[model samples]
Target: MFQQFRYFKPIITISLIMLISGLIISCGSTSSIPIPATPTKEVEVAVVPPPTPTTPAVPTSVPAILAPDDSCVNCHSDEVQLLLTSATEEVEVELSEGEG
Candidate 1:
């Protein structure tokens, strides 16, 4: 009987050690409280209209310029008439008659 008690003493020692550690851990007090989450709400936006584009107007008519022979007559009509009368038959560079 004494032999059996001596053999079980180590098991009793280990059990007591486990029980003491459990008692020490449970002695602390702690409580968890949940926070209320805010909702993500979308805002309504107003639609803006686009601006109209302005058009540029262009003018139509253009003035005409005098030809080379007409400009020569405009500056010196008397010289042109005198040269026309004095020109020979072989002088093939002929002017338009009465054009000036």
Candidate 2:
């Protein structure tokens, strides 16, 4: 039994040495070091003046030049006016016939 235990003595000695070294390394001092301050630079800034206010021009009359035939102005103005006039005439004719 003593002969069999002799072979494990070197292995146990190596394991104990590694464990002690690891403990000593982990338990060492952990002091904080001071950092140096950086120098500041001066910057130049330009001041701008505010813009002056002006009156906007207002139109007193419509322009003599007409818009193109395919423009939305023709569709909204001419087409809508024709439909309104025809609808009023039809309503007037129906009222006259009903009265007769």
Tens digit of lDDT per residue, candidate 2, span 14-98?
Answer: 9999999977876673433344557676776775444446645555565557644547665467976768765444433444544
Tell me each candidate's TM-score: 0.29, 0.28
Checking candidate 2 for backbone clashes, the offending pairs are none
TM-score of 2: 0.28
Each model's backbone clash number: 0, 0
**Where does the lowest 10-residue lDDT sum fall in candidate 2?**
87-96
2-94, model 1: which lDDT tens digit per residue? 899999999999999999986776655333335457787888787544444654444544545644456655546688676777647575677
Deviation of model 2 at 26, angstroms:
0.8
